[model samples]
Target: MTPAIITKDLTKKFGDFTAVNGINFEAARGEIFGFLGPNGSGKTTTIRMMLGLLPPTAGEIQALGISVKGNQAELQQRVGYMSQRFSLYNDLTVQQNLQFYGAAYGLNKVDLKNRIQDALAMAGLEGRENAKTKDLSGGWRQRLALSTAILHRPELIFLDEPTAGVDPISRRAFWDLLYQLVADGVTVFVTTHYMDEAEHCHDLAFIQRGNIIARGSPARIKETMMDGQVLEISTSDAIKTVKVLRAAQKAGKIPLKEVELYGSLVHVVAPNIEKKINDIQAILKKAEIRTEQMAVIEASLEDVFIASMK
Candidate 1:
């Protein structure tokens, strides 16, 4: 089957800086493709290039099996985009906003009416059609924005940090909506900073400093990119434990690849961490830090991503 989106050596530059270096990836139809990256890592730039809103300095992008270059108008009609910021009119009523977007996408009056009703139902705003968009909560606004973006039912949708500021429950709910879209054969390309959200994607690409440092399914990335096993240490002072462990690694006292603090726990990654587990506990104990519990645990997407960033 043809891929929903494809890019080869896709690149973008701004005079002295390259926002996106040569990066290659593909998104299959009816799948959630997560583009993960930190701020200024070219995720947004790449999305803009794919949407044909910004021209790439070099390379090619094929979205929906059509070349994005010189075919933006054609592509625009077939794809929907929800930008990082809210794109709907805050002053408009919920139904009005949906109507405007439906019309903007050239939906006929009859189709618009049906789509408006669907959008209202999808957003759980059936009786709140007359409510001002500005008065809705962040979660409601996010759902409304999504409903509006899909008002025309495009084949593919690009969502840039769609759940950024929403609460965890809302984020989960938004992802539920995405799964529903995929079940209905809509392809989703989303860029996000949430590691949990990344885990939900069918496939993922981690970009940093304009380069794709890692790419694969969540399981594959954890298996391939993690060079060492993770040792989860429940400690009294995670921050200070990390500092001590980092210093030990740097000073050649401990052979650890990464040391990070996860809440009250300290995670240390190293090859054969079990062999050095005793040494780790001894080192922390000598520093007067109590090691409550220690165990080898599975590598998480966050662990792999931080390692990749380094």
Candidate 2:
């Protein structure tokens, strides 16, 4: 199958600064492709160019087998989009908002009514059809936003941090909707700050400083970072122990990728970690420290992201 989205030498600039440097990639149909990166990494810029919302300084964009160069009008109808910020009309009733958008899409009165009801049902806002948009809570607002985006069941969806700042419960519910979409063959391209969210995608695009550093299954990303194991050392002196681990890792005494401090605990990222645990304990002992506990564990995607960003 042809990729759902494609780009080549995709680049964008803002006067003196290059927001998105030469980048290229493809997202297969029905795949939940994640765009991951730190702030100012140009993920948003690239997405805008793909959607034909922002013209790229230079490059080619293909969406659903159609060139986006000047056919954006034909392409927009088949793609759903939700931005990082809420885009619904706060003053309108839920039903009214849905109706307005439905009409804009050229749905007839009967079809529009049915589509509104379907959207409300899918978003779990069935009983709030007459409620004003502003009266709903944050989670409800999110549901409405999602409901509106998929109101037309666009073939492809672009969600930019759709769950950011949402509580874990709401985030999970939002992800569940995405799962249903993919099941129905609707491709989703999403960007998010939450690693747990990214882990749900079929594949991830990890970018930094305008570069696509990694792209693969979440499991692959985590495994690629697992050149070694990670161990946590809990002690009363977090500062001292963390300092020692950092210096050790830097000086080659510890063959670890990173050392991070969390309160009274120091996490060491290393390979052949079993052999170094006792050695680390010895070093801690020299500092007149008492260890509370030490254990080995798998590294988190967050850890890999930090290491990658470094």
Candidate 3:
């Protein structure tokens, strides 16, 4: 079967600066494909080109088996987009917002009514229809946005950082809705910086300054991209631990691939890290940074992502 979205050397530029440079990837039908990167990493640029909102400087974009540049009007009818920011009207009531967008998608009265009911139920906003959109919490608003985007039953959806400001519970709930969409045979092409959320995707492409450095499943990327094991160190001070380890690495005291802070803990990445545990402990001990615990742990997607960027 043809992929849901396919790009070959897809390039976009603004003046002389290339925002998305010769990037290629494919999102299979009925799957969640994640585009992972930090801010200003060409994620939004690529999405815009795919949606035909921005024309590419070069190369091709075939979404749902049609050329995005040539057949935008038809593609718009077959695809949905939930932008990075909330695009709904704040003063409008939930019912009013849905009704407006549904009509804008060209739904007639009867189908619009039925689809509005489905969207409200999907968003869990049944009783809140009369409530103003601005009155809803961040999570509620995000769900409503997703509901509005899909009111047309598009074959593919583009979500640009859909869960940015929401809480963890809400993020998880929103992902549940995405899972339902996939189960129902809708292709989801989502862009996110959250590694935990990236883990949930079936496939991913890691972008940096417009280039795709890594592309694969979460497990495959971790398995192939990381050249060493990650030694997790729980120290008295995360900042100090990273500083000391980084100094030691720079001064040739330890053969470290990367020293990074993960919340309150420090992770040291290197080949055969188990053999250098004593050296690591000794350096921290000399620096008066107490090592509460040290263990060689599995590398996470974030670890692989950081490694790839370096």
**By lDDT, highest first, what's the ranking?**
3, 1, 2
Question: Which ten-residue region of model 1 has the weakest summed lDDT?
Answer: 118-127
Better of 1 and 3 by TM-score: 3
Q: Write candidate 1's Cα lDDT for 1-310 as tens digits.
A: 6899999999888998988999999999999999999999998899899999998898999988889998977887899999999698999999899989998999999999998898888767788899999999899999999999999898999999999989999888889899999999999999999999999999999999899999889999999999999999998888989999998899999899999988788889999999999999889999999988999999999999998898
Clash pairs (backbone) in predicted model 2? none
lDDT of 2 by residue, 244-267 (tens): 777776788757777887446777
Which residue pairs overlap in candidate 1's backbone? Answer: none
Model 2, residue 226: distance off in Å is 4.2
Alpha-carbon lDDT, every model: 0.92, 0.86, 0.94
Best by TM-score: 3
Output candidate 1 Cα RMSD.
0.9
State the lDDT of candidate 3 residue by residue for 132-198, as single tens digits: 9999999999999999999999999999999998999999999999999999999999998888999
Shift in Å, residue 61, candidate 2: 1.6
- TM-score for each of the candidates: 0.98, 0.93, 0.98
Show model 2 residue runs off by greater than 4 Å: 237-240, 250-253, 261-265
